[model samples]
Target: MNKWRNLAILTAGVTMLAACTNNPYTGESEAGKSGIYGGIGAVTGAVIGAATSSKKDRGKGALIGAAVGGAAGGGYGYYVDKQEAQLRQRLVGTGVQVQRNGDQLTLIMPGNITFATNSSDISSSFYPTLNSLVTVFKEFDKSGINIVGHTDSTGSLALNQNLSNARAQSVASYLSSNGVAGNRISAYGAGPNQPIASNATEQGRAQNRRVEITLQQMQ
Candidate 1:
């Protein structure tokens, strides 16, 4: 009877938490997403707590787990949210696109703005933009940075792959030099294999030739 009552209470708590998906006052979707993490954590923690605790203390343990897990999950969401806001503010008019998908943030740097034609060297004009990124990255030091390079399908596979790798390395080196932790960064080259746009037209090819930097929670 006690076990059943505890389960019922947990279920009702999770349901109420899920109902907060949309913030009534701010109307921000992010609040709702954070709530979802809290809900999931609460459920998992409750299960573990009930399983581990003595039968007599099962209810208390479940409740404690639910509170701790919910706070941890929701705290992660809030951390990412604050970082995204700072990124958007810092990257304004910088030709870099700040994108958010859940707790991850990606910055798409176009080839024309980031590098020279068919060259691995970064364009001089893009330095200021990178400096701004350095500031934000240092502030949000808990995230891992992934730098990926891409190219159009106009070149031989080997050449494109090599060039992409070189570009990624250059970006990684720059970030490392600017005080972002080296261990937290990884660079990869997708070359023409991961073309985001078609290679059939000049515009498409141009779009495909770019670098993407993705930041994700370290843990």
Candidate 2:
């Protein structure tokens, strides 16, 4: 959708929201504020997500993509647009899931591809993927990275916690060694405390054991 059209929709939503500040149902101030903001947010989000989406799917993904990109109402939208495109192109077939939220980008690397079973040492096979990522980071130096590691609930919490931290550091170290700036990256380990999926099944457990490289646009 054109920016002008999007702006028109946003303006209408905000105006309507402002005009109905009092909730009719509960007689409370700012009635249905959440729904109003959600509507406007969805409009603005299209600006970021629509570009990367396929022409046919643009309409469906724009609201989500823009919301995820946290699009500011300016040229920063374009900045995120370019970065998302570059990531999609560079990380193709790498078994990494790239997700965008507003101005943030996250690269989800599953344990099966990122590390050996219960090990934090850098896997030699993963080097090329990291290299590809480093290349992009160099090209897009205005982004700060966060490497977060997570583990399934198979081992003791203490051990899993340590392993998670080790995995994060290991990835960060590898990226640093390959020319990505240390100052641009922060590392954290969540261990089993932050599971994206249930640990009751192997599939869920596998999904939980992962590393996430998140990028935030620098100010």
Best of the candidates, lDDT: 1
Candidate 2 Cα RMSD (Å): 13.2
Instruction: State each model's C-alpha RMSD to the native.
Output: 4.2, 13.2
- What candidate 1 gets wrong by more than 4 Å, as runs, is 1-33, 40-69
Q: At residue 196, what lDDT does model 1 achieve? A: 82
Across residues 107-177, which tens digit of lDDT does each residue of candidate 2 receive?
Answer: 99999999999899877888889999989898888899999999999979999999999999999999999
Error of 1 at 131 (Å): 0.9
lDDT per residue as tens, model 1, 21-98: 553335764344567777777777777777789988888878877777776667666687778878888898988998
Clashes of 1: 0
Output the number of the TM-score-best candidate.
Answer: 1
Where is model 1 poorest over a 10-residue stretch in terms of lDDT?
Answer: 23-32
